[model samples]
Target: MPKRLRLTRRFPVAMTNDAYRRLQSFAREAELTQDEALTFLFEHFNSVTNHENLTARLRLFRAELEARKA
Candidate 1:
């Protein structure tokens, strides 16, 4: 039998409208709830992308943080 993964944590999050919209869109397209989508992303994060590409994107996102918040 396969082990079941249970979602038992609850937390508060504040996101920019754009970020929230992106998450909503992703969840909708993937046919998963937002919580499940988030869980899946974090769980598979390591295998999901090229590390160098992710790092580059992270740096670019950091630079855009101020503008994104405005």
Candidate 2:
């Protein structure tokens, strides 16, 4: 049998009804339980592409800030 990995985290977040409904819809479309869908998203957000995008955005913002300072 393949080994399994487990993670535990705790946090409190507030969401609007619209956001909750969208998450439900995504869960259904992806054929995952709501919790599973959220887990998938958490993993996705940590992916290389996402990290690169965030880095690019931060660099852009820093450039703009530096331009203002100069």
Candidate 3:
């Protein structure tokens, strides 16, 4: 059985009408409910952060090095 997710945060966001329409179109095209689309987006974003966190950290380190040189 799939585990149920307990939502912990509620934040309000504002989007332009164009963005709203595009999101609706994507949900229809992908056959995803709005909640499913949001979940998918969060999962993908987390995956990218997991993969790139080390690289991002290294970039920060490089930025500090350049700052010290300057």
Predicted model with the maximum TM-score? 1
Writing each residue's lDDT as its tens digit, candidate 3 over 1-70 gives: 9867656666786775877888788788889876666666787775646667868987897889767557
Model 1 agreement with the true structure over 20-41: per-residue lDDT tens digits:
9999999999999999989989
Model 2 misplaced regions, further than 4 Å: 1-7, 46-70
Give one digit per residue, the lDDT tens place, for model 2 in 42-64: 77776624777889988997889
Indicate the residue-level lDDT of 38 in model 2: 81
Which model, 1 or 3, shows the larger lDDT?
A: 1
Q: In order, what is each prediction's RMSD in angstroms?
A: 1.7, 6.8, 8.2
Error of 2 at 14 (Å): 2.1
lDDT (C-alpha, whole model) for all candidates: 0.92, 0.78, 0.74
**Alpha carbon lDDT of residue 12, candidate 3?**
85
The order of the candidates by lDDT, greatest first, is 1, 2, 3
